[model samples]
Target: MTSLWQHARRPATRDDDSWSVAGNVYYGTGRPIDGMERPFSPEFEAKVRHAYKSNGPVFALMTVRQMLFSEARFQFRQMRNGRPGELFGTADLALLETPWPGGTTGNLLSRMIQFADLEGSAYVTNYNPGRLKMLRPDWVTIITGSEEEPSLASEAIDSELLGYMYDPPTGSEPWFLLPEQVAHFAPIPDPEFQFRGMSWITPVIREIVGDTAATRHKLKFFENGATPQVVVSLDPSVTPEKVKKFQALMDSDHRGVDTAYKTLYLGGGADVTVVGKDLHQLDFKATQGAGETRLAAAAGVPSVVVGFSEGLAGSSLNAGNYSSSRRRLADGTMRPLWREAAGSLAQIVNVPAGADLWYDDRDIAWLREDQHDAAEIQGLQSRTIRTLVDAGYEPETVVAAVAAEDYSLLKHSGLYSVQLQKPGTGSGAPSPTPPTTDPEVP
Candidate 1:
């Protein structure tokens, strides 16, 4: 098949020694006839990483995602008459299993999810046939081109995806890869851009900031004698120098968790009035929990699944509710991500003629309940197949009908079973002794 890049003009190349310098030169230089480069913001990605590392809820949510996503292994699945058939393993899967030397499928998957969550996209390239390399999403640029002359105004409609450019931080010459050579996984689409993704965290950035601020407040509360602020009044006769010395002494002696609840000595004419509310009055739990829930919601993970305060409190921890939450994360979030990842990675892998790349979650412990549910569903389908076959439907068609849940696919044979047939018409019944006796008697 002729590739899109083959028809488009080649992008102008610069002999600049530094990739950053070339990038600066090309920045905002209107769309080239060859291709337009779309780069992710490194600053935003850095902030995402900082949140992942510093925020407890964000960390937990992403960790849960990575842990579950990595459990699914890649396989080949063929479509049977527009429906998915059984998944079969292939040698091509080996590339994913051991993407790089000493790197397991889990490592590769973790990196992919981490990058995707952080930067809103993940890029993988098999520039070297047998080995797979993950490109830093922020460092990689998507190259789009069009057959028509490039115009800034209509670039969105006219351009077609050409390939990718990987610019390393070492100021080395960037490597340009064909679309087929790179696998781009962007689960969430960016609203403002074409052919780009937006991070789940983007929507909940305010929540994250709020949560971090709340955490800082809690730490400060503890650091400040673990008590609320108090207003101190002194008599007019007291010297300013004396007040300053007394204030310094109070702070030095009473500040921090270790000195909390210590006895306070007040001299004559000194009065301390309690002013600020304590942690209980402030309701820190509710404050932070609300933000955590919002973050979890954005991540498409139930707060319960990540053990957030909101999820663990009240009825959320009930067995049924917890189970539902787990299912939501597994089915709603992880499965879709895995599906997208498989499809993206397929671009670089040699897929079988009749098969597409897919993920197999049968072995994942987190989805054991799903496996049980599947078994029950299979059993029901088996009963349906048996009933249809016994009703004289073609066995193949019966199986297909049961599998697809479309009874219209069933085809009946020209014969019926004994129960379905009228009294003596059934083949199972003894035929009337027609011949000799009847003739003789007649």
Candidate 2:
């Protein structure tokens, strides 16, 4: 709990003289948001939204064009789609429509923290994998069936789980990517006939679809589990050929889409529709530093960016974009904004989803990285940006404003870029329709 300001320096690390800057510069700390619960302020969104529309749009226009369209024309499409009026009015974001469970207690923010504690790490929805276990026995069984890692779950006919869970047919796209938890709990539940244990599983299934195979999968698996000889039948939800087709479209049409969520949502752009399994773990990573090079180059909105991100890979694109830019000022000091952010990580707000790095108001958010999503990020970012400008900051002061919202914004390499205003060469291009709203809000 000792802060960098409190510690006397040993005077040096490596070849740098940042002795005084040691832990002081790290941007993750848990802090309290003073009046985040207050009503939405209009001015806040205008400036922040404008910043995103301008900066992020150009970046997004740049990338989606080469990948999806041909430049000049695409940027035009971007503008047309970005008409603020279409998404919102001239006011700040909508009166926060927090999810069911999130609206209780003091509010969503408080509930988000509580869920993180009860469930271990912060996630974006009431659909928390940990919580869902009680609702979806198939997931509970598949999850309980493994001792593989700390974060794991199982479910059939549940696209949500299929996004993050792994089983026999977990082909090419990789259904299991997070494992920080203690993994593979003892006594794995029989994938079939397991839904019976979860009181909510049956209903969710019946509602999504009538008493079809998926329902039967839940019914027979959970209901007949007690019967040895007459148990439910099991089949890979996504057949091999279908998996191949899905993977192809995923790679070509929906690249950068968060696979975990994608497995649930299943497509891309404004046209993407979601279905299937119900297995998605949440890892709340939400900022890429308060507008640093990484963020700017990618044209990410300073507030909650709501897009999906494919897991990092050494793409031909990324492989060729390395840079040598550094932001140490003449006096060997970083921007004051950066300095400030490093000192406060836990209190950042409106953090976006699919961010390379995000700022936070709580250190615990870091531990939940596996299942984090766009909703948590957007919520934090949108709200925080509003708080900053409302306090009398100018648009030019966006970086400082974000740093003020939560110091962890400095942890991002973008923390440096927002200062520089030049997206480094290597960061991937911007996304179109910019992946949006996390699992919770939408």
TM-score leader: 1
Q: Candidate 1: which pairs clash?
A: 225-256
**Which stretches in model 1 have alpha-carbon errors above 4 Å?**
1-37, 40-42, 147-156, 393-397, 404-415, 420-431, 435-442
Give the 10-residue window scoring lowest on summed lDDT in candidate 1.
19-28
For model 1, what is the error of residue 276's alpha carbon versus the real structure, in angstroms, after optimal superposition? 1.1
RMSD of each: 6.4, 32.8
**Candidate 2 segments exceeding 4 Å error:** 1-97, 101-106, 119-442
lDDT of 2 at 372: 54
Predicted candidate 2 versus true structure: per-residue lDDT over 318-435, tens digit per residue: 4222111111110121122122221121122222222211122222222233235556776787786665454444544545435344333232223222333354432353533546
lDDT of 1 by residue, 172-247 (tens): 6667898899888999987655666767876676687788788989999999979889999999999999999999
Each prediction's TM-score versus the true structure? 0.85, 0.15
Instruction: Give all candidates' CA lDDT scores.
Output: 0.78, 0.25
